[model samples]
Target: MNKERNQNFKKKKIDAESSYYYALSHEIRRKIIKIIGDNEFTSFTHLKKELNVSTGTIYHHLETLSDLIEQKQNKKYYLKELGTYAYNSLKDNIETIKAPQNEFKSSFLNKMMMITSKRFIMFHKKDRIYTVLISLGIIILGTIFSILNGFTSFFLFFIEFNS
Candidate 1:
């Protein structure tokens, strides 16, 4: 049980880390974070000019990064603590990645993982809690029955040998 709990904790941590990266994997979002991270505050207009994206596109990226950024009273955006950490982490990590020999392999693996995770989540949601309980009950009953049968066989062998 203790081991299972540890595994679950590790799994949760991995899921959260992977989800964070997945959210930030977009080109526009990464640029927005980089721009906001370097400066004290950036207005929507500056981001629009830097990214050369439409106002709506900038707003969408902002919405995606809402957790990391906060709007000031003057309507400029600044990174929260989380945003700063994310920016620095991205900068450090992305700088280390080199062009892979197997670009197709990397993309294929990512797509496969995405599809498998989606299907797994759907199946997990649909699985009933009672099914697990019922399986445990069946295993327990089977074990008890097997032990009783073994005792009966031993008793019969002793009685016949004594006679």
Candidate 2:
């Protein structure tokens, strides 16, 4: 019975730790942590202002982080020892999550490729036939004109030679 209770307690702690890490993975959460670290204390309003996030979003993230840090007074939050340790452990990984340059490039490329693919698909069978017909008509007209002009020049030379 004691062993089972200890196991449950450890499992809860691990779950909390995982949740804390997942929350901290977000860029906004990292900014919040930095802001909290700088101020040492912060309210929801100030956090929303500084982070430029919706009040609900800020509060949700704060609540998640607070749960990891442990709730103390009502409407107030602080990072406890576990929270501090989690933040420190995640510091390096958090820095990489900021701005996401690679993700932006990939998204841009995907959009470009989608647009190009649509344009290629827009070339219907009629359009293809029209292009081929136009090209063939131009070639035939040029060939006929060239042959007629060549015959006229040859006939003129023959008349001059005979005269």
lDDT of all predictions: 0.74, 0.67
What is the C-alpha local distance difference test score of candidate 2?
A: 0.67
Supply candidate 1's per-residue lDDT for 133. Answer: 57
Question: Where is model 1 more than 4 Å wrong at Cα?
Answer: 1-19, 98-163
Q: Which window of 10 residues has the lowest lDDT sum in candidate 1? A: 154-163
lDDT, candidate 2, 104-138, per-residue tens: 46777767854454544566776777556655786
lDDT by residue (tens digit), candidate 1, 1-163: 9999999999977865764676488988888888988886899889989999888888887887876788999999998877788889878876656435344377777687544534344455445464455557766776667566553234224221221
Q: What TM-score does candidate 1 get on C-alpha atoms?
A: 0.48
Pull out the clashing pairs in model 2: none
RMSD of each: 16.0, 16.1
Which pairs of residues have clashing backbones in candidate 1?
Answer: none
